[model samples]
Target: MEPVRLIMSGAVVGQELAAEFGPLPPSLLPVGTQRLYELQLAALGGTRQHLVLPETFELSAFDRERLVELNVEIAPIPEGLRLGEAVVYALNSIGAGDTPVHILHGDTLIAEPPLSEADVIVGGRRSNEYAWAEIDTDGEGRITALVDTRAGEEGREHQPVAAGYFAFGSAVDLLRSMTRMRGDFVAGVNHYLAGHSVKLARGGRWLDFGHLQTFFQSRLAVTTARAFNTVRIDGLTARKSSQDEAKIWAEAHWLQEAPPAVQVYCGRLLGFGAEDGKSFYETEYEYLPVLSELFVYGALGRQPWLRILASCEDFLRTCAGITGSGSGDAALKALAADKTLARLERFARETGFPIDAPLSFEGRACPSLVSIAERLVAAYDLQSGAPESVFHGDLCFSNILYDSRVRRIKAIDPRGLVGERPTIYGDLRYDLAKLAHSVVGRYDQIIAGRCRAERHGEDFSLAFEPIACQPWLEAALGDLSVRGVGGLSPAVRAVTVSLFLSMIPLHADKPERQKAFVANALKLFLQMERQ
Candidate 1:
């Protein structure tokens, strides 16, 4: 079969969404590690796909290059054109002659689509959502008609809605029908169906992101995260851009500001600048498997996890050696002690958490939340001169990426702040605590919503999703707990437990996660007290 001439039209980003995410086409929104359009192109099984984008939506250089890498021909169209007219305009714009034309809406994705050699098949999703065209079918379940709900409501109850994937045998016939329909895209589709025996291909795996609620629903279903900045990535480069001057400026300057010996472990910085009033920077985006996802979800055996831990430890130790300092006694105390307590108190006030009362987790009685914070803060009295280092302030598992072929790991997204200022140096124990929270506290699992945390009176129950690699995780945790790499101090446990509590306010949107954070902190705190 000859390759289908594919054209995808992503719904133009609306004002509300553009205001928050900065004019990103819904197709380009990050889903997991890749963009929605990248996933669409991969699943739709098209060759040299053409993407129709609003001409005014100024294509970011990184996004244009990324789309070009996927062989997507950029067919820029004027804004305000009707969906049908726009699609037809895109088809007429392309030079392919008499080939099969496959049209897909960028916001829709189907897993394992039945891309059959049928003369006409239109994609439908099982949704009662009014945004989609209500599909009508004959006795044999062939698509007979469509009721576009955008005009008026019809019998759209739990029916297959035209969620926008179509494969027509002949582009010439499609153009003839669509051209006459003009701005009425649904009418054009119906006109074509009237002449052809159209098949309804409801792949059951249909995902839609056409509206505000559905967009986030589908996005969360695919993956998650980040608020201060927006990150765009191609195969070779990542650009983290934000209007927040302090955050972007610090991150963009990190490569140069970092200690020379520690700089080698990070992704190479390409450049940094302000564009359209937003601060932005670029870095080499060498795709590596994220360490957190691999440890928990990859189902790897003991040796693989061990090697990962070893490589990570080596990397951290090398940086620690290059970064150790005896300074910043006051700032370290203020950031870890005062800032943490402030955040924890804010969490209590926000969630009505009974911080003053003693709490228990898994039946183990523990100190009041405030008392725990005080103890942890007391432990971090840097006046005694614990060694500080130029550190990745937020060195959680998610930020560390590993390439198995080369047995190397590279880190990204340094916290880049200490106390009230932006800097590279902090207590090295804090960095270890960051890594420890991943191994022992299972911080990633909580963020992924794979853990359970339920409250009953003053007691709580918390359990991470069961994993086959739990034993290996336990083993690794024990090894790290006893004698941390680079002559670590026992203060890591205090800092790690405190971290779970202090971070609760940051994820205020996830109430269950906030509860989980409290529960995890109590669990880790009780364990530390017993030890």
Candidate 2:
């Protein structure tokens, strides 16, 4: 028996897509570490392929090399031909004579391939819109009539639509079907089903990403699932994007060997529940053992505050020890040149505030404050000409869990690396800056919605629930000053203060609180400058 040949059709120039992203080939549209066409190829288990291109298509050298690697033959359809005619033209060029062939659309993303052993296999998904497939299946799961919507009102009732995946036992039959398909080669698969016993496959998720909106949606779904291993639970209010917190909970089972007892309940994923179009990461239903958040506990007493500080100190020291090697200069450049500062300017415009101007804190505006802050940070590099180590990317108070029973503090939701790059050991200063927010910047209260900004034209006054543990803040700063990198310098203070400012544009969930954080950080910067 001859090996199956995969034929992919993506030759047409999507006019709207061309006007925006570029008039590039559809298969080259990027998604997660590879092109969309590469992903489609990966989904199929064929060694040989025939990829059809448009008459006006131009292949890049890189793409050509990739085609050579994949054992693919490029077949360009001529101008002024319908899709069916183009497909026929490509097939005739290959002289695909009676070999088993699989037909696929390049613009679609399939989560998994439908495996089948039959004369013909047609991948169909439940859909109300687009081409509908009226499938008459026998008790043995063999399709009798694969009627298209063009078959009139009776055929329109087909609930499962063929969303661009077809298989044939013989290319001779497929060629005959292509001859019959006068137009719209995609929908033409319906005509090809006449005489062949078709198997309707509903094996995995199928998404049509031909349009811009659906393309983004499909990308988000695929990437999110890949990153978080999302498992939506029933009767829970968790969203797909909010699975980071759940990930911490789910991963605790593996990360729970060390002391401090981070999670009270950690276990394997039981199962996910998807109802009403909402999903939740399903784990064994158990209450998280949290007496109170470290923020609330710190506000209650001085001893609790000290304990939280010590716990955080210990946890950070542990993280700092898990070091690795990378270019310190490169990491510092990435951090210092992060686009948050530009976004800060945009945020000022959108919120009608002068973020660049001196902020009024404790009834006084420090002279040349924003300029001074910028100069101090700009003059110094956080990496300090040495490779740094792993640090919790977001060690804010909200991310810290204080188990008072064990008198231990735990951190959650490490901001991992940026993109596919290992940003894990970029700079220790970023982590220190975030940690400082809880003490000097009053981030705990700010996150709890106890922050507000009063704007008067070009000036603004910010108010936040005052940070109560000044001595604890001083001690923590002092400890970090002695042990952390870029130690206790003017640059360190500026970076810490700037972290708060940088965070203001990030919190779309609570803009008022972010403004307050900025104010608090500004006040700290003024004090540091005066010293």
Candidate 3:
């Protein structure tokens, strides 16, 4: 059968839920990386689909632009329609002929494909909570009559409820019949039920994300599904890893070439894991790519290394302004108040390093470690917040893979969270801090257990052999400043300090490494103060 035109009616989704996450319309609320409307379109599996909206609804420029990107055609319901009449008006406006039209509620999420052999199929599920649609089906499962079961309807408790999914073979006749009946689509369906043959598609996984409770629950469910799925690609085993890695793998393929200008040498998505919980999607493995940590530790030219950082920034800048991501100011305040500093202080005390011990960098005695930490936290708290962008949460040198022959940089293991939530909006300063740790903080050596910290009388010192990325690092900073991607030096420094401090808790079992990270953060805080 030919593909049908999907009519997604968002007019009935209501304004209360549309503005739940922010000012974002219901259609734009993010499910994973994509939005609710985008997911529906993907489920329909066509080039484009029809999006129906209320006549009074005004589309934001961003939303309109995104709809254009998705190749969606908007159809609006006429103004001054009664409750439930808007969907019928919108449907009648389609001028449906012989072609089948699939009607779906925009707020609902149905994972199963629109696969049905019957001329008309109404998706439903048997549940105790819902006002069940008591479906009377024939021997072939063709629905005879749909009865709405209410609380007082004693015997209809075990019936299947219609989930707002329908397929119509003759849209013109059905819509015309609905206009005469003057009711909701389901009411209209019930009005013409005697003549048309309707099939019941029952027991499919579905969710109506209209209110806050259902939306949040469905969001978590989708996130969990996105997090852990198997991947299968030819000549490669997609091993199960963190959610961040899986998202990065999918994103890398979406962006076939790394931005600014470099090829992305990462796996391509093939689907779910063949081995249970091992992976989410598989991809064709690129052979002989050098892990960037090994490449950076080796004899690499400064220009190529600088190019990778520049290209990374280019990619990040393009992915800004995702809807429902939290405010930057709030996130920065949370970061400053996070338990990382407390953990660092504990590690310092356990390692026999006094918090009030004099800290010196470049032979200049400045403030004590405790004083520096307090000042930095205070400074971060006073900040106005940085501009948000799509950041590789862990952009350390190790997560990058460089193909020497192809001259590409494939980034792996993205953090996928903005603030405490899984979102794409994050302060660029966080990413900058991560990259800076590899250069100035010597995070790689610290992780390798090569970093050492010592207490001499009243002074504490940290020592680590530096890598050869200094010249490139300088170039990167200059590029960021020139390109206006740099937020503020003080904010970046505060974030960098937090980055090192946060590592202390991550290495709690390794007291030596924890001490080194604490010392590193203290030194960075002091340097920021000097600056």
Best by TM-score: 1
Model 2 RMSD in Å is 20.5
Query: What lDDT does candidate 2 reach at residue 499?
Result: 68
Question: Mind giving the per-residue lDDT tens digits that candidate 2 earns over 1-531?
Answer: 543544455454365443323444566664533556777777765666777777576665556767888877887777667666766677678777767776676677666766344354555654434345556677876766655565234344435566667667776766777677675564455566666767767646786656554565565544423333443323222223233444343333223332232233123244443445434333432211121232422223566566666766666666556556775445544554454466567667667656566556656675333464465556446446655565556667655655555666655445545323534454566666666666666665555444566655434566644445555655656665424453345555666676666667666556666657666666776777675
Query: Residue 3 error for model 1, in Å?
Result: 27
Ranking of candidates on lDDT, top first: 1, 3, 2
Off by over 4 Å in 3: 1-235, 242-292, 321-325, 335-337, 345-370, 381-387, 404-407, 450-452
Give the alpha carbon lDDT tens digit for every residue of 286-394 in model 3. 4322233343223335665666666555444544433224555565555444655576577676666566666665455756655665666665644554455555566
* Model 1 alpha-carbon miss at residue 301, Å: 1.5
Worst 10 residues of 1 by lDDT: 481-490
Alpha carbon lDDT of residue 529, candidate 3?
69
- Candidate 3 vs. true structure, TM-score: 0.46
Residue lDDT tens for model 1, 1-531? 554545455455665444323345667654555567777887765565787787776664546767888888888777778887777777777765667777777777766666665554555555443556777888997788887665335444567677667877777777878888875878887888878888877564677765555654565445433886777765457888888888877876677688766776777889999898899889987645566765444445666667777776766776666544446455457556777778878988887877889988888788888899988866654665546667777778889877665666778888776755777776667777788888888887787666779999989999776656665765665565312332224467788888887888998888898899999999988877776
Selected candidate, larger TM-score, 2 vs 3: 3
In candidate 1 the C-alpha lDDT for residue 510 amounts to 84
